[model samples]
Target: MTETVFQEESEVESLLSPLRSFLKCSTPKEWVEEAKKEKNLPTLLRDHLICELKAAQSAMLLIRRYAVDEESGKALLNWLKPYEDFTYRLVGDWRKLADYSSFNKRMVPKSRRPYSQPLIDKMVLLIKEELHHFYQVLEIAEELGIKYDKITSSRYARSLLSHVRTYEPAALIDKLICGAYIEARSCERFAAVAPHLTAKLSTFYYSLLRSEARHYQDYLALAREISDNDISERIAYFGEIEKELIQSSDDDFKFHSGLPC
Candidate 1:
């Protein structure tokens, strides 16, 4: 019986390892390669750090708008206070900030009774992981001497957001759809940037691809969960909009920006 149990655990781990591998591509290898490059480490790490903060900011906005209510929202704001205060200075151990980004909240109500538990669970976990990844990126950035500067806004977010409808559930649904677009684009960009970077950065970006892929799926899942009608129509609508944004020209040289303009 013990032997059977051990075998089952091993089999499960083996299956899950691939999923994990798919998330960041080759994180360990990328890290090793970064050490070898030496000269490029600072730039690469800074880019990664900013990306991580952007990711956390994305998650923060999501919960702030959709998940948290009045009182808890204040708490949430306080939780992120440290990062907001010290994106550059590192007043304290940044890793400790990871705990503040979880799903626990007294003011936020649970998922709507008839909603998709699977989707909610998945998204909550995605939020947690993304925040953790943000910390890892920051730590790496510190190691390489990168300073976090005020974000000047990227065209990537605004481009997809322009398509959001100007009304209630439809508005909410469209935003969720936009979320899907962002996650999909992030996944695509991660794959695109991987080869151009050093082994460690490539590995880290590659590692993110899978989670980023699933994030789009999660957003899509929620969009469907909220609507009784088939969501294929909505998905198709967003896909067209997403494609336009991806294929267009943009001035920013950031991660998800359009053709180098």
Candidate 2:
């Protein structure tokens, strides 16, 4: 049985080969062991659901801030209203966030530049997928009898976010790179813990791996598309920062945290 599961894990790792190459480092063994503990699964799922919501919100921010005109900005807010309502106000049903209908057709961009539509398209898809994942996670939490209690932000994201550049295109590029790292790490963690989960949970996490992998790719692709110069140097720089965050000590035991101090 162990050998069979190991073989399955190997296959999953093979599927993540692109992410492995794109990321500067692997998730540490200590963190993997920490994540695999049965007791940690609820906290992991709770934080993971929050992470998904944040991911969608992050993408929406990019669209609203960088790409959308004022009218479209209001539409964007309308799109996000249900999710935020469920999350913050808890005034609406979670099913409200599950809708994926069309927004306004006139998503006028601030500029007619080549990268605008690509960013809008990619981020829109990401928002849809991440929101769906968030709802799915809510379902999982319900099944497992885990309440959606609040969790403190993990150091991993804040550590990288603190380094975002203050300029125009560079700021955008940095955000894209950061997005790629977060998605890649999430995919890595899902694989690391899936085998240790109950079959139902394991299947759900595995189902998400492919979409998360593509999200990283989409972010990377957009980064490369927007940059005039080669982004390798910037990619390498962010990779180092990400590696440091993962390799160093962390106090929190949330998803994507480093080995606990």
List RMSD in Å for every model shown. 7.3, 2.6
- TM-score per prediction, in order, is 0.70, 0.92
lDDT of 2 by residue, 40-72 (tens): 888898889889989988998998888878888
What does candidate 1's lDDT look like per residue over 12-37, in tens digits? 44434533433322223333344345
Show where candidate 2 strays beyond 4 Å.
Answer: 1-11, 100-106
- By summed lDDT, the worst window of 10 consecutive residues in model 1 runs over 22-31
Model 2 score (lDDT): 0.86
Residue 224, model 1: Cα distance from true site in angstroms:
0.6
Model 1 residue 163 distance off true place after TM-score fit, in angstroms: 2.0
Per-candidate clashes come to: 11, 0
Q: What local lDDT does model 2 show for residue 159?
A: 87
Model 2 scores worst on lDDT over the 10 consecutive residues at 96-105
